[model samples]
Target chain A: MTTVPVRPPLVRSSDRIIAGVCAGLAEHLGWPVRMVRIGMAVAALAGGAGLVFYGWLWIMVPTADESAKRNARRPASPIAPAVSIAPAVSMPPNQSAAVGPSLWSDAYSPGYPSGPVAPPLGGPAAAGPVGYSSAANPAPSGPYVAGAPSQAEGTAAVPGTGAWFRVRNMRYGKEILLGAGLLLVAAILIARLLGVEVPLGTLIPAAAILGGAAIAWMQLDETRRAGLVDKTKADQAGGWARLAAGLALVVAGVLVMVSGSGSWEQTWLALLASVAVLGGVALVLLPWGLKFWRDLETERAGRVRETERAEIAAHLHDSVLQTLALIQRRAANEHDVVRLARAQERELRGWLFRDPARDAGQLSDRIKAAAAEVEDGLGNAVDVVSVGDTAMTDRHEALVQASREAMLNASRHGGGPVSVYLEVSDGGAEVFVKDRGSGFELHTVPADRLGVRESIIGRMKRHGGSAEINSSPDGTEVRLKLPAAAEDNGEGKS
Target chain B: MSTPALDGTAGDPGRTVRVVIVDDHAIFRSGLKADLDPRIEVVGEAGTVEQAIEVIGRTRPEVVLLDVHLPGGLGGGGREVIAGSAALRGTTKFLALSVSDAAEDVVAVIRAGARGYVTKTISGAEITDAVYRVAGGDAVFSPRLAGFVLDAFGTAPADIADDELDKLSARELEVMRLIARGYSYKEVAKELFISIKTVETHVSAVLRKLQLSSRHELTKWAAERRLL
Candidate 1:
């Protein structure tokens, strides 16, 4: 059987006259609604403080609608995975027995119906239930069917009870501490007015303990949350809470040091004592803060390295690995292998060192460079004549490589004088490698030859352009053209 | 009834089909010339698109064996030669010869008013037959390249949305279709029976109406819409 998820406590909109506070408390504490009402009435008869408490609860406890809205607005945490619920089959039969008297007593009452056992507090299971129940019930009345708090309501009630030790619970903790401190101070002032003496030493230590506890609680929460020690709600501490707690600690430390001193004349000693006390408290807190800082730095560096590694892997897969696979399939002889190796080397070197982002140099300059390289390598006399200076930075490498291949083929096969012509137009850039050589029939070109196929034609096609080879007994000409813009139209014919 | 020989080749002078070979490759041209039957006389030859236009204009060959990718003709290839020599369109037929069988290459040349396209891999006898078929005013293409022509030109041009064509006037629309199908300005003028200057004005108007930058883009746009 599927386990029913526990839901958060929310004020019942349907069950209350003034406010849903009594119904919400009754549901959350598992006490009968009638019993909670009787208790509240008795407290109200004794003094009007119960009414004030009820008023505070009404304001603090969100209505069902408000809780639902809050749950919807909360952003999903990137680092936190969705909490998973454990099956109810493994749950101990007496699990409800461990719940405190505040709510557990109602579970075992002879007259009471056996309700669903409340989820174990402050565990991953508790977090799971709140989120799950909200998702399971699209309407507010669905939670009432189960006689349990709605998912949003459960999350709302966590800070007041189940999640009291959680860092996020401190939002309400500060108010409670402030209220208690105010009551204590009022009691002392009233006693003094009634002619009773209040000792300064006793008051100072109490204030110190309260101040130190607040500061220490905040510091410990920061460290524990930073370490993700319990993995229970990693809620961030509010900026104001930290600031207020820090101020309280400083004030309490100074006051205690000054009051404990016997003479006002020894001002330096008292000041030094306050500083020493503050230093001791800070020393106790430093290790956790230091660990958090170091962990954050290491995590950031690791993420950067991971991103860089992924980029490199993608680039290699797209280019080098593909070429290697093709080479393995097509290599027939030593000559074919050598040609493939040279091509691979050129491609690898370009990928490693060429700045693709930089603007491609002039078309004329590229042609000249290609021609000069061919002449120097092959000892061929090449005359280069360039007419335009169009820059094609995007496909610059492809065009240059194609032109270089054309030049290499000419120098290798052509008879005598070779001429390279470069022209740039609005449509595209064109480079012509013309040689006065005995031209061979295109169809007669052996399949083993990689010079014309892979080097010239394939390069241009890869760059979204075309190559034209025209050869006759008069001379051979290779016209390499690159389109001005590369528009990928989803046809992989290239 | 014997006709005067066009190039003074011996044997069956009266029955000879005078032809010009317009390929940039000299060795291929020589091989093709040596392989052709004596009945097919070689009248003139040119290497570049400009030279092809000049020679074919002067020779007035019955068939021109044109290479699709010739340089030096206003940045256009074999299409430019057909465009430049518009007056000879009626008397002379063009049969494109190229190494590429790519659909774009086949479609571009055919749309430019070539009578046929044959890859260089075709046997000499097959090329000879294609030339004769083109000279007879019947369209011809290698078996593989025929699909490209059918896909491009055989379809009804009405596949494009009405809104894309609504802005263009009748004359502008006609010019746009031809130009987008890869015909140069001169060829479009010749085909439409308008002057080249008039074709230019209509083309620019169409370009403005359709917001196309160039003929290359226009061809791609038209091809994408299956209007060609």
Candidate 2:
């Protein structure tokens, strides 16, 4: 008895067809499999109930191994009955010990067990209380005469125990109601078309009322299902309900107008009234519906954009900015410094403006190229040293341009061996262009001389960075700092 | 490169002003050396801060033509040369020469004890006369640079109170400027020689202190305060 309570009903593995419902049930109940199949076929022929019941049982019942697996996974609830009905007749030795306490409890318990009482009837009557109580009490429990009295008494009280209400609250309740309503409407329509004088006025109104009631009930059910305590979500769902109600009203109005038979003027008047009602409802609700939909769309789009921005920011922070900072700190000479600056600029520009992605070639190679260019033009020795790698290829062009200008300044003005150092770090990159020549005054450069102004300072400014020229009689060192990330557009001026 | 002949017609070697060209680039040095009038004698040249100090100290020239931004120091550039070679402040007049025309650069070297600041674009004759004037103990700034020196060292009252900026530490202020300028946390850390985590901490502290929400707001605040 305890074993039966623990295990769910199992489908027989050695089945004929359609999941072996009749066979599995016959074996479980100790009935002849042929007799059960013949009864099922007779019920199915009478209507579709037996087929539907078989399909439902096929889906609900697990195989022996599956039942065992489910039992192992599921913990028994304290309120569940200790004795199961099947084992009482099938396995007698275990029955008495398990059945004793459960039989006593069943006789006294207020709420009768609903699970084991409904499977015997092979039609729509399975859901009906009359069939459940009558069939469950009389036949199977007869073998255990002592236990039969308590079992029969327990099942007898089940119908009045609000069992139907419990069933109605199940997740599929709305679907079942919708299917029934549609079937009812189809049946009525078919009956009318077959020349039966059906009352359209009452029937159509009744259908509309039923649909509206179902929608309202479903909305409330869904609200409870979602566990949304907040009013806003409930209100949103209510908006949907209102929209449904408006549609149902329009449908009801059309049905009434179609079913009416009167003078031409009277019919025209009725049509006008129906149209005005629909227009009024549409006028009142359409803007609100559109606004609600638009708000939801904008909110979703905003969330997506924000997430994308955060992702981009995190990527840049980890890779590009870090490398640029390192480069800024370690760069050794004008050429290498310029190259790093260029690379940094390009990276920033690309990031801010959403330019096409570029391959971040080796930082060392870029520095070398910058050094080579400077060395060629200035006829000066430039040493390049760089450490680390970064995949930031945004504003490199502007940085490189500024760096070239700084190098040009060094070669043209400072006039000696220039050393270019490239330092990349976590935050930004710095390029130091050092010249072993005379340093001059920054403020003394003529306004018309745009090399330092436009090429170095202006370019850096445009790229959202700064250029610092530290010059003295000892030597001039131009330090270019390019941040890893920058705003897309420059602020008017700094 | 062969050194060009200094014009002998200007003055005798003994009576000429002994000047040392302290530029880092050799080509410019040689060109300046060749172009200088005979009155201003090119005695020595040095590329970096250490070399500049050593060369200027050894020659003890009347005037040292200093490049504003010299390398080979602890990132101090030309200012370090002036600060390091403080011993020759009165004896040898230091005239700064560079391509930068930023007022901050001009003021920095001047504050470091340079006699004058001049851009490298000056004609060779003008530089020679400027060197002569500097050597003679007269301040010799380029025409445009004179305004920068005055503005930097001016006695005018500040347009805005410093109280707001005084709320932050130097490091915090540095971080704030970078953040306000749209530098990422990592970039700020690199610029300040700190960790990204530290940069984040500083940024948070700045935002908290300023009662601002984000970097965007901070930038707007800084711009409004003219801190950028």
TM-score, per-candidate, Cα-based: 0.27, 0.24
Best by TM-score: 1
lDDT of 2 by residue, B72-123 (tens): 8786778888787788778887888876554456655765667666667556
- Model 2 residue A396 CA deviation (Å) reads 36
How accurate is chain B of model 2, given as a TM-score from 0 to 1?
0.60
lDDT of each: 0.58, 0.55
Q: Can you write out model 2's per-residue Cα lDDT over A1-494, one digit (the tens) per residue?
A: 65653432446555766677888888877778899999898888878878887887777667767767644532321111112221122222343354344442333232222222221111111212211122212232233333433443354334423433443456367557767976988888899889899887666665676666667666665443322113356558775877578566655555554656535676677767877997999999999999997997686565445434433433343224433443454466546444444344333433443313333354434665566566555555454434233443557567766777777777777665465555454456667676757788878989999998888988898887789987766567788887767542222111
lDDT of 1 by residue, B1-228 (tens): 000001111122346799999999999999899877777989999999879988998999999998988889787889899889899878998888886544566666766777666766456655666666556555542333322322322222333454443245566546544432223344457668987557655543432333222335436634543210
- Candidate 1 lDDT over residue span A1-494, tens digit each: 34855544656554896797888888877779889888888888777877877888887778878877645533322111111111221223453343333233332343222332223222222222221122212233232223222332344344333333453465467668868888988998999999998886657666766676676676665544333222233233453466567676666555556566545556556667867987998899899889998998687565445434433443443334434544454566544443444444444434454444444466555776576566556655554544334554658678888989988888789855466655454466667777757998877999989889998999899888899998877568888888677452211211
Candidate 1 segments whose C-alpha is farther than 4 A from its true place: A1-5, A9-46, A58-237, A261-494, B1-228
DockQ of each model vs. true complex: 0.01, 0.02
